[model samples]
Target: MTNTALDQALQTLERATSTPELVKATQALCALNDLEAAKPLVKVLGFNNPAVAAVATQGLIQLGRDTIPILLVSLDARNYGARAWVVKVIAALRDPRGLDLLEHALEADIAPSVRRSATRGLADLELSEDAAHDQLVRCFEGLLKAVRDDEWVVRYAAAYGLEQRLNSAAVSAHLAEQGRAALNQLASDAEGVRVVQLRALKALQRLNAG
Candidate 1:
């Protein structure tokens, strides 16, 4: 939490107007890993410049769990891009406190990026041995719904998630079976895009190999 790097980065960010300069300052602030960088990075997520926003997202994620609370606050920002990137940051942190937020973002009215990221986040969840069976079932059901999502990217992410679920030692037999059924449906889906079908096929192969 040294002020030197944050102080310099803040000065640079304050003076930065161009995309490159903004991105540079954001990266610098992110590398500092100071709590002060959290709010700045969250604010940058709403930037009109995509490059700056993208770098801010990476920096915020690089800051790891320390950025979670600020990000959760930023989640309420009006910008869709900011919300979507915050979903990704929250997912990367893997803290269960963000789970309800992610699930809520899966609504159809939300942006595709947000929904897709939330889907991937749900798929990445790891439950403890003592976790409730209903919780596991709910997660499994979420993934199943994701696999059937209208967006191909969402389905692709879900297919990859199925592979992880089937391979996870923490997942229950019943949940694994559910994952298998979802993958099977995707693999045999005649109307599905070729790339997605291929992903489903690969997931099935991995399941069989395991």
Candidate 2:
């Protein structure tokens, strides 16, 4: 589509009162892949509509690295829901630029859901570790800590991460030690909510079977 055509479509998206109109505009913007669509797509992430949010996220990911700087800045957005969505986008991109931000959010974000998303980001990353293995160890340790987080959802996410990786042949001894200890503790968590403990127990079961 031409730049003028893209701009008009985005304007229609902004003014869209009905779902069909919004979806059409969203589809147009996704097809356009113009840099100008980044801000509007980011705004769509904050919308209460899940369909719009999914479309915007896919569009932004298709736009690729151009969306990273905008997303990084948006991490500071006042709306926690938007921040949560932005983190998921960054996680999907798997850009190293997002690693520090993801780690910080995991450690400190006030929102459990944001922290939950951050765990997935950290889990799926392949960081360039130094000789001391700080980066790799940090990622593992962060998941370990998150497995015991106050929120059951956060714990569930952490357990999910460990569960998926329990049998990987490539796991280093150090990382395995960290993951196993954390999983074992989570598996037997006396005070955790039933679902959280169940996830932990399942992860441990998977580990044993692996």
Best by lDDT: 2
Tens digit of per-residue lDDT, candidate 1, span 1-210? 678878889999999988888888888888887778889888888776788878887787777777667777677546788788788888777766676777777755357788888887777765545654655576677788888788888888889877876776767877787788888888885636888889999989977887
Residue pairs with backbone atoms closer than 3 Å in model 2 (clashes): none
Instruction: List, residue by residue over 116-170, the lDDT tens digit for candidate 2.
Output: 9988887776555353256556667778878768898888888888865556566
lDDT of 1 at 66: 70
TM-score of each prediction: 0.88, 0.86
Local error of candidate 2 at residue 208 (angstroms):
2.8
What do the candidate models score in CA lDDT, each in turn? 0.78, 0.79
Model 1 residue 9 CA deviation in Å: 2.3
* Residue-level error in angstroms, candidate 1, position 34: 0.6
Name the regions of candidate 2 deviating beyond 4 angstroms: 129-132, 165-170, 189-191
